[model samples]
Target chain A: MLKFDEQKVKENMEGALKLRPQINEVVDQIHERGFSNICWLGIGGTYASAMQAVVHMKEKTALETFYENAAVFLTTGNKRVTKDTLVVISSVTGSTEEVVDAVKKCNEIGATVFGFIDKAEAELATLVDHLISYPLNEQLKFFMVADRFMYLAGEFDEYDEFYNEMDQHFAQGIVEVEKAADKFGQEFALKHHQDEIHYFVGAGNQWGATYSYAMCYWEEQHWIKTKSIESHEFFHGMFEIVERDTPVTIYVTEDSQRALSERVVNFIPQICGNYTVIDAKDYDMPGISTKFRGALSPFIIHAVNNRIDVHIEKINCHPMEIRRYYRQLDY
Target chain B: MLKFDEQKVKENMEGALKLRPQINEVVDQIHERGFSNICWLGIGGTYASAMQAVVHMKEKTALETFYENAAVFLTTGNKRVTKDTLVVISSVTGSTEEVVDAVKKCNEIGATVFGFIDKAEAELATLVDHLISYPLNEQLKFFMVADRFMYLAGEFDEYDEFYNEMDQHFAQGIVEVEKAADKFGQEFALKHHQDEIHYFVGAGNQWGATYSYAMCYWEEQHWIKTKSIESHEFFHGMFEIVERDTPVTIYVTEDSQRALSERVVNFIPQICGNYTVIDAKDYDMPGISTKFRGALSPFIIHAVNNRIDVHIEKINCHPMEIRRYYRQLDY
Candidate 1:
């Protein structure tokens, strides 16, 4: 409510929903054509978002999926990306150099390229074999592209049903997340505004959200120190850094890996001095089925985390959009 | 060598060399028997080490390879892991619970498992189908496991020749790395000893070393904050965090992707106030071929970084081995 636009959030969600027909048509055509494997490519937030699709594919489907950073993909070409490979890439700004280069390489390799470009007239839109032009909202665009590929992989027979459920439930979820963010996010930011280091943990699909929120929203936006590790990997080595006052944020998805995060949720309070658990299970998705909630948690969590982004900026008096070096100076 | 034992380094290098006959026999069997894919499983450092093998596979061979966190693997159960899948795991203590669980699961799936166990009497030694017992040195163990996978994937026609070369050149490389680390590493620690945050950048095979050093050594061992990002991904979002005095360490591997890391080497110094470049090329890896240097750089870099670890501990007056929570208190 402070810096977040509720109307913009709803419009972004609806825009993704509106692409359901096109997503279905494109997926059907790809399925009919037949592909060997699926490849997801992007950079930064987009790459983190594609990682969620990879986790979803691992959990729900038997499809061979490869998720890679767009820049790295160019240097270390995936051997699996042959003529039969399907490459799905999303670039909020169609001019991301690495994504454009990757798409060009995919074309050279004769792989089927599906591009999700925010701008209709962007470079990636022209480079890709199939372009899905939409308004750029990194979070929503991720869902649109990932959902399309997931459906094409034949994991969900009720793809249309799920899309309808999203249409009915996403607006309500946003309002609920906004409320939670204003209450909890504001309180947490006020309490820990001076804290320089934070740790974020998540498992399954929500792991990507956990990582993106820390890197894109927290570290890049605010220039804070953050480490985003998977929930299961938390106990491995990172758990050593748990001082009493160290802030920890756990994004628990309501998936098969729920127990994994729950383990940390129960343990952190006892060992960590400060901890915040954003359990997607706590969110009430009005019309969404329990079965689908786990799969849809990433999108819901994105909306929820969006509020924290607003609150941290509000409390710190920092412009969330300002960067010290990124695009400000060419490297 | 403040903390490093030169004798131990040579012994560890030789121990890895000693495993070659067994590694070769097992890999030859797997190659002749024919497996569908390769699965590299470990937790934390071991998982990070496994990642280098995955990168090597991507760069050199067309093998369908999967590198996963052992804990996450137990929960997610890769659809790729079948009777035809070859699961490679390394457990130094041979008692990592999640890794043992994963090995059991892989066994249940009838997948061929190769275990690199530090202790001959460890639990994983009993669980795996094939076991290579040696003293636990993360660097050498990584080389041993990764080389086996690389050979099994049919990347090398002269696997024995490579191993013999390693046997001949590894000791000299270790000694050379020790000298560089003492000189370069000590200077770095003295200058940036108070720095709390560090950014590690690497490309190609050295990317795994960059990550392992940041997470496993710095964060886990020293309880410091670190962001280990691939060189290509640095420009994506993480670069925004670069301030005038931000500490950035670049690991420049002498591989085809050397240019990738070089781009960051040239860029970071201009924007970031302080930076350290640990180019593997700077170390004289005598008798090792230039074409092979990139693939072997992880090992060379590991030895070189070990000196930095020693100096960081000495300067900070902190025992790197002490853990606040890891294995100290049970969760």
Candidate 2:
């Protein structure tokens, strides 16, 4: 019956050094097992985390990482998992029924399961092969899922340089995110964001995070039209359809890619479209550079989800959380 | 130089045969070359085709297909291309400035080249390893960019009975698309769709087509918010966001998926979202089934670009033919 604390969560994230080895071991096990195919499954931020991990690891694992949407992982019936599969379950609560069902099937089909969960005793944890314990709960998000997850991976994977960079990035990113959030009022930007369709653009590893943190959540929560494209692809003819009114957002990951990011940011004003962009490099964080992984960029993107949600709520004239359980779950 | 006859265009679409083998063949070449890792470059529909083709073939080829936007592909100063690759040129007219530059550089890089062109003698025709010819200029879109290039693998590759089914699907598909287009402007649907934000959703192999078509051209051209998503994924959470003001169009692809399409259609009304859906199987052509190949489904989605633009104009009160531009080629 233990829950999460916004402050404690923050402390854990702000000081993720404690959980490093736990996370490292998990990433290592999965990496060593080398499941040619992987399905990262979960809900909300957990789902987003799975995406970030895949994005970071993608250059390494490529399409071997698949985000399994709970509703339709099954091709026919009862027979969903494949033998050459590694199922990674991510959930702050480890209570999502879909994740539970998915993991069970994966086990049935003889697939290995790897996950990071808050509680070792959670049902979803039972079906997993390597369950890395971490602090997740309602407060997990407030603690900043990005920093915590990144640190966990760093401690375990021993990417010393990357860890150090991520640490620097997080400490600084927190302040910048707060400042940006304050500037993100509805009339100023959210009004603009909510009313039109949006495209979330990023390049390399940052693209997947853009998909989850920007495209999927924004579209789902607000019923706003949000699509994502990576880098220069948006300019291919898509540039023509972009009018002065079109709102596009670019995810900036690091200094090296800043030029590429800036190139796109600079083009929007000229491309007959209006845009709001976030530069992760400029984001106040402790050591963000090392955290830049092909599969890991989503974590950076996740760091911004709430700020965006806050602004979206301002435009929506509603609270940021979805509270309805009126309709019973279909399954 | 051919102009369009609305009546004939509509009628001929009915008579058009499914070019699945041709489409699949083109995809196969893409797949084969893709196995070796090639950079894809193009402009306009060619770019769109390149994007869809690369995305479609990624599952089979892994990370080989790269969608290069015009600015980077054509105008780059030699950093992007190398000898260990191939370049696919897709332009109906084969004369766009960026398209030309992309092909020339690849030739300079000694990368194998492939072209899907409307005119055999088009400038890009001189730049490739293999050329797939089409009457794209007369057919409608000169850039065979989306239709042929996007579909090259599917169309030019070896024929399959399934491909025949796909052809029958396209012929019949045009009719159903027309029907969907006809319903687009109803006062009820218009209140939602025409209001500045448009969204489209489809799943499986069709994800690319739905995502690209709605997100790219539909959203792009109309100066509205548009989006596409995999169907089952939406239900995982987006369903609750549906409200009366929301308007949705679902692309129902094949016999196996018809019932699933209907279920979603039924849900749209129940959730109070304004919606219009089309079944590809409803097309005038008969016997073909809509099947998916990894990321390849977007090719079919690309084929419907004209109808999307046409319908946007028909509903938004724009003139019959919005002469945004007509490309007169130097070639």
Candidate 3:
């Protein structure tokens, strides 16, 4: 719990939930105006965090969704993004060079750009056709964007109703997250923070959170060696790295592909010396129904990971905010 | 060129080129039949190799293309797939369980599935609606598929004509590959094969090759630590991990984003001790036009990396073919 702020976490979650009405209003406008397809663009963690929602939208909705790295899109133009396409993009600073350039390119192509940003007056906001300013918590911002798309799809009413209940019990949910961290996250971090390399494995929506945590939290923030491998592709090539003493972190979601994660969970412990399993089912979302708990695994896993991040910072004696090159050096 | 096989590589290149007519015929059939969109399904190296083609299709074609991991696609269904959808898949051995399962799922969903395989009597070929059996070189198979999609898009006739010319000089091209490897690849592998971790940075289509070599070749084959990061995102987060002696292999292509790759090339060597910059412009493809050289960078780079693979194997005393778990153990 070192450096953890219970009040700040609660406020951040609450602030994001408080924007539900605005987000719904924006969704209404997008629906009214109409769009041929949806384009989600970002770089690094921004790109990684958007995967969960993209996967969900792809499964339950017929809407064609293009989730691309902002820079990659600039190199390989998306043929699907016509004037009728609606693009959802996010950058906390509103000044990520690749994303800003991507927004400019989108404008040139006459696509309708919708942005979610922390800075209302920043360059990205200026370039976007519509901007929804929000506080910077990647999980919350991605959730808001995904919620709007899911609402538009009209295929997840049950899950949406469950999300509303989570919103109602928002503070209680924060309390539960903190309690779960004490029992799970901090202990796991304390045990394995010094491992030479860590593998983060998960399936379904939680895979996105797993990827984001490996890149943004472990590698970017802590400079720790990490690799995020999806459970489905784990056997393909990456699983070769697994040795008897290899460190592995497994995220088990309640999503449709829970069995896939379960497969790895069963297999890894038998061979890999270290297995840190964070199962979303272990965390109690007081007012959230079991049916929808799986859908919210990405957020739940992210909150647990935040606690682990605090513990890792304390153990490594390195501030998570310190950076050797990111934003400090020009490339 | 420690383990280079000059005549074999020439034959391999010629064999792949010889299939161009067959590939064109298959593409003509697909064009005549018509499809609502394109879905590409593969896993591991197969999935990684398809990126260049997908990007090219996205850039020049109005046709919407979906590139997905075969296993991930099974768990999270692609809503865009229907009877009208043309799904293209590849597996060399025809026994990749996930791909076979994916083909079965596509059949159940009534989507038209076409496969590129090594054998017509193989499982994947049998499951697919149509099959183009070919050699195992990723560059050739992907080119066949992409050429078909680009031909359908009706914007890449010039590039296609250039490809035909290169195909005619296929044997001569292998010599170019060896010359480039002697000048570039072996020196790189010899210098930095002892490094703990390596970063592969590139932009445009080469990004896909970087990723494939990182995971499928280095990590999977050699069990070496590797991270393939896009040049644009390098500044965002992954750049923080770089140190004074960090080993970085940079790929500079002649594609539209050459400036982007140049940015990374100019910056990395100043901070990192080791800089293996493989610029495609250095390789000479005799019959290929200067304007079209950039488009051929992915193949040129792949061939160069193959030489580097030989040196890495020699240094580590680990044959690239040996695997501890991949296809050796059940997941």
RMSD per model, one decimal: 2.2, 7.5, 2.0
Model 2 lDDT tens row, B1-331: 0122556654554332333345446546655555344556665445545544543443233233455655444422323245655566666667766677767777877777767676789767877777766554222221122334434445424334444454445444444444544433343334553555555767543554566565445545555556566665555445555567677778765523334455676667666556767555443433543333222223333334455555556667654323232221111
Going through the candidates in order, their DockQ values are 0.65, 0.19, 0.66
- Per-model TM-score on C-alpha atoms: 0.95, 0.69, 0.95
Off by over 4 Å in 3: none
Per-residue lDDT for A135 in model 2? 66
lDDT of 3 by residue, B77-133 (tens): 788888888888878899988889989999998988878888778867888887777
Q: Tell me, by DockQ, which candidate is best.
A: 3
Better of 2 and 3 by DockQ: 3
Candidate 3: give its CA RMSD in angstroms: 2.0
Range of the 10 consecutive residues with the lowest summed lDDT in candidate 2 chain A: A137-146
Best by lDDT: 1
Per-candidate Cα lDDT values, in order, are: 0.79, 0.52, 0.78
Ranking by TM-score: 3, 1, 2
Ranking by lDDT: 1, 3, 2
Task: Please give the interface root mean square deviation for model 3, in Å.
Answer: 1.7
Error at B8, model 2, angstroms: 7.5
